[model samples]
Target: MTSVSLVAPGDAPLTLPVAAAPAPARVPTARRYLMCEPRHFAVEYRINPWMDPEQPVDVELAVRQWRELKGVYEALGHRVDVVEPAPGLPDMVFAANSGTVVGGRVLGSRFRAPQRAPEAEHFRRWFEANGYPGVVMPERINEAEGDFTWTGRYLLAGTGFRTDPAAHAEAQEALGVPVVSLRLVDPRYYHLDTALFVLAEDLVAYYPQAFSPGSREVLAGLFPDAVLADERDAACLGLNAVSDGRNVVLPLEARGLAAEVERRGFTAVPVDISELRKSGGGPKCCTLEIRD
Candidate 1:
């Protein structure tokens, strides 16, 4: 496989000052993640309501914030890897949309929008070159981590906005896991990551309003002790979070959700990535958990 540089010349190395926190007892820490530096990140297209091509972005701030997020994972002793950012593909910084990784196999994304289509190949190639050769390209339209997440045993998939429901069957076959499909009703919650989060095997935090009545019922049945996020936190993109069984890394603006997470015995670490939210992503969107 041909190697592609996953970073730019002036991009800062992954190393950063570590401020380690003691891991909570009985909780498993994430060991690996895939991230991309916001070297060429910008709001050049209006793909979502969050993006306004007319407005300008603070490129330097985006880079700084992205690095800080990477640092948080490193501080927690997780391995972070990069996929070189292609010049024209600014949205590539939202790495989670690339694909879903489970059991060392990557089911590549078939992007809904044309602007993000090229990113599928970039992520696929990165995984192929980085030792994960079981990369399955899906026949149906799906946006990997953006619409799919694992619950330690089963696969939770989201559709109705970017991913097609047909892709859920593909996921079941590709990952060899039972797949539960959830329908996203609101456009603001375009991706599943924006509405629901898998905090642990049996725990989840989500905004009920984002899903349809039936989908909401399915979630309720699946996770009886779900942490419900109020409108305030949901609007702030608080539900888009990454958890390591014990600790959840979320946006600082989501105070209500943070409090709820803490009440569940998990330490909530808040990191500000407001600049990246300008492109319709938060902490979870920037990091792709490499389960392999």
Candidate 2:
């Protein structure tokens, strides 16, 4: 497997301030991936074959997909973080947002939706195994892992959808991180990531339709150079792109968005995640990046 460099013009080399820092390299261009061995959601929402189904998915096939994803990551020399699937909470296995790592501490999340409650158990085990300190969960409030977005100084939590208003307040008060609450009302846009993602310290890509006036203002304030994705492409999960400081992984259908990402001096790799999307997930939904 040949490794592709993501370095682009005007991109500064990354450096760690301290000696004992985790890997400072951003998302590797050679690394592209998806999650295959997913647990099934309840039968109630089984309309999408990629989602919870009236029948269970073939376990063997799921395992094969997992191996494929792992193989791609491993081939690219990127370590794969695997979370054991939790029974009953079918979506629990989508481990990316189980928690957020900041200042070398892992804060496990409390999901707002009941169907995903089982995620806490799986996340707890993963955190413990990874040796992270000081995990916190809101006592009475419901907060989804998808709701929280963290930068060095601030953490913004989205309210509405699965995460509640009360949880947003709790995240700020309990976590000791300055929290800004963004409201998302559209049912299609279930999480903040569905419409917005921070590309860099000063850059973000998002769709305005999913954001409240206040939320857009907050984004504009925090990232002055934020770019808006076209609605057609945004519907195809264009705004959900992930950046590792070098390359971005975007939905395969978003060609225009991919060009824009490349225009910004980042390499854009289109990946097929149709299987994961059937279950209301994407590339970001599949894996957790443990920075340390």
Candidate 3:
């Protein structure tokens, strides 16, 4: 398979300092995941920095890549559940934004962009149909797992872009888990999952420049040994990955970070979803882990 260019047109090259990842024994565990087919995926409108209408999108390619990602989960012995795609809701393929699931309860999404607002209802219906009842739809704008990512003991909630700070407290109250608010400084990494990812219960990986100084400090304190991504990987949305403790499946375009993950004692499984990346999403964007 041909890999997409290291950087897209109009994407200024970002070369920053890199750090070595310390490898440690991490056992893999099967997980239950929810994904949506990218049948209607397109770059019709620009809600984030990554979307450019001039950049052509291929729905067929997106579907194939999405299926490959789903297959990766299945091959890893994980259960993959699908939610039907609703036409006109192009971004529905990013199932992670549908909701934040912790302790088996769903915290529904409220999209900040009007174009994606309708997606919440469609996702909510899927949860209900799939036996997830009484899903808490927060009044404040929170893009579900896009902004709210659970890191074992606490939920690392993001703000300053799509999700509101108020939504952080709402999720904490609803999920009964402590929520730590991280302020995203860059539009490119608007979601918490985009900049920070939990690799295991005690380990994580992140792009430091994507977050504010205070937020970065908090992350340093929380996980001092977290794998830090260089600009090349972070630019390709490499930090947006799904890890099953021992295995990490991420965008193939983020090869630099993939190597880092492997050095950190995790098997890095890379898949190309360049078509989907045209809309600012990678592997983690398409996979939502249901913590039951």
Candidate 4:
């Protein structure tokens, strides 16, 4: 009564099996790092007067102050990654500021100051020992100490002061993540973090003068809840604090910033880093927190 016939399609079509959605990647957890005892940049102003008063830093005190700061991070339940001091490399002592940690990889950076070149080696060894992806030293480009920032989702590469455009591009390419290159017109505004810090994905702390008008507009649009830190507060370690995912470690001078941080329900812990600031660095500059 009823006959059913199956017929192939008139035209042959090539088809591939649909790939199952990749398992959602596990978000890396935030882990803190402690650098080796502080070492001086060997500037004459820092050196002893009898020997060389012009040294830019006082090594003995810097080392002690560094350790104190390191202890604070430890108290926050973050793991510490330490590097031993190198003999010939003076700047190697400031390892945290030299490189950017992207995901599981640590991209060794090239420095603007020729004297800081030796700093890369120590970072290489540290990354290797910790079972992190191999360190990639960006070739054909040089990045300065203030060139980079690992702001959770994206890496910010500041161009002009210590990092050139080429260096920023290389870091972005090697990391395989998006990078935003900010044009820094003012030499004093060396790093993006110097004038801007991401307090939350939608919130930021910034100084208007630090960014160009275009960048400022972009930042304001992206972070509508941004709390603008007064210039005086910014100069006083306000912008140099760290947000441990949820809470923040504030600098003592950032009184205004701290008040806002607390209002937002973040635990704002004020740290005294007068010693580090003397060298033009602060809390954020002292530690590199690698999120795993």
Candidate 5:
């Protein structure tokens, strides 16, 4: 047999073991989000306790902060889609209240307060125009993601505030998911997203004082290892967070909550949206997850 040269002619020839190529790195799927620009965002009307028409809102600052928030998501390799902001709808920037998108269907919200009533039509039109699989107009008063969120298994619905108890049944039928109703007793935690947040599969972070005793028990049973937020952070809307399993986007002032999240193996991304908070919204309020 002729000897084969493993090197160039006149160069030293050596034998070497052939190695197998390493497998390609697995890339994680990017999460999709829906956001609205704070063009006409201001405290024009008093809806939630956080909103005060007398308190002036720096419109320009709010816009800049909102843009920064959108940039945060884009930098993390997540897709961000925008919905056109309506001129007179000051609260339109809080897109979370628009509706709940799950399994390709959009269950539109019906506002309990007339100040936000006009927002329902705009959101419904957007979903219909986008050709969602299905768009259900809720008959009962529901604040969409403001009071409803998915925990990978069940949809936790909040009531005794902006959302009506009757809407729980409507959400179940409309979204085709099991609904767990939780009562919000405190005015500050009027929206469910403000008091409770689902961080990952079977993991959550919440403020116990926001919920009634019964609701607190329910949450404890459902999420035993829930990260409890202290009164300071909770007051700063620390529980109002958006998590994509590994990364959690929350308020910059929520240092305590961020620490808790870091301990649980999640990267805490703090974004300052204090301008938006004046209107009763934070990072989560500005983001609406598109499950489809």
Candidate 6:
């Protein structure tokens, strides 16, 4: 009965179907996640638009915020596993870029930036050392979970930024899953996870302006009722929020996004990870979902 205004890549308005399907049941399942301590976190170089070398970083505050984010997972009945943060590798704290894990198989990371390239090997070792079987590292550049998002059915792969187009095929081959490629044009929403994330198996929330016209149409067709975030939410890195189907954990500054999810029959749990965002990361960036 209610009208939903959907936006294409260029901010073109697209209305929802007159007769929409019934809302699905919201089920919160426990998750197993991998995170890195912000012990060595800092903004030494500018890789993304959110990063600024001029602005100083407070390691103490970053650690505190990161701890709080980890705490949020614990409170949600989710298992939080930590990988040691190596010295000199500052952005390692954003562990979600490490790689993708689905059905106990991993498609490892191959970073685009030289500054963050070493992070891939470090993450690869963690997977192999931690009982996760054969971790296949793609030769082509890919940011792993950062650009490849598992939507429970298909892998929404991203390109035109960090991940290379060839990596999508490698992921499909390595992980034995279907991948849908989405091109990102905006520098701010460099990673697909930053511009969009699955709220449930059949649903996702995204910022349309970050995608191309064709990619936006593909998303609109796939998720008709996907939550659309406003400029305010995107600015706060709100679409980077992580959802366990029922609980959505996002940045506290993402107030508009929190309200949107809450209205859509989901619990919005906001955390203050502002210190981490200084390096172009939020809740989802720091947390890597390990689906087994």
- The best candidate by lDDT is 6
Q: Taking the tens digit of each residue's C-alpha lDDT, what string does model 2 give over 161-209? A: 7667777676766556787788886666777777777666556788877
Give lDDT tens digits, candidate 1, residues 39-155.
Answer: 999999888888988888999999999999999999998899998999999999999999898988789999888998999999999999999887999999999999998998789
Assess each prediction's global lDDT (C-alpha) against the native: 0.90, 0.63, 0.90, 0.65, 0.89, 0.91
- Candidate 2 has what TM-score? 0.76
TM-score of 5: 0.89
- Write candidate 5's Cα lDDT for 1-292 as tens digits: 2344488788898756665544233223578988999999878887778888899899999999999999999999999989999898988998899889888878998998897899888888888888783688888899999999899899999998899999999999988999999999999989999998988878899999999999999999999989999899999898889888888999999998999888777889999999999988999999888898
Candidate 6 clash pair list? none
Instruction: Give the runs in model 6 whose Cα sits over 4 Å from its true position.
Output: 1-25
Please report how far candidate 4 places residue 183 from its true position, in Å: 1.8
Alpha-carbon TM-score of each model against the true structure: 0.90, 0.76, 0.91, 0.79, 0.89, 0.92
Arranged by TM-score with the best first, the candidates are 6, 3, 1, 5, 4, 2
Q: Tell how far residue 184 is off in model 6, in angstroms.
A: 0.5
By lDDT: ranked, best first: 6, 1, 3, 5, 4, 2
lDDT of 4 by residue, 98-150 (tens): 56766666677676666667777677777778787577887744453355766
Cα lDDT, model 2, residue 78:
68
The TM-score between candidate 6 and the true structure equals 0.92
Instruction: Report the Cα lDDT for residue 108, model 1.
Output: 92
Cα lDDT tens digits, model 3, 139-177, are 999898898888889999999999999999999989999
Candidate 4: stretches off by over 4 Å = 1-30, 39-41, 45-57, 140-145
Judge candidate 4 at residue 96 and give its lDDT: 55
Q: What's the lDDT for candidate 6?
A: 0.91
**Where is the poorest 10-residue window by lDDT in model 1?**
15-24
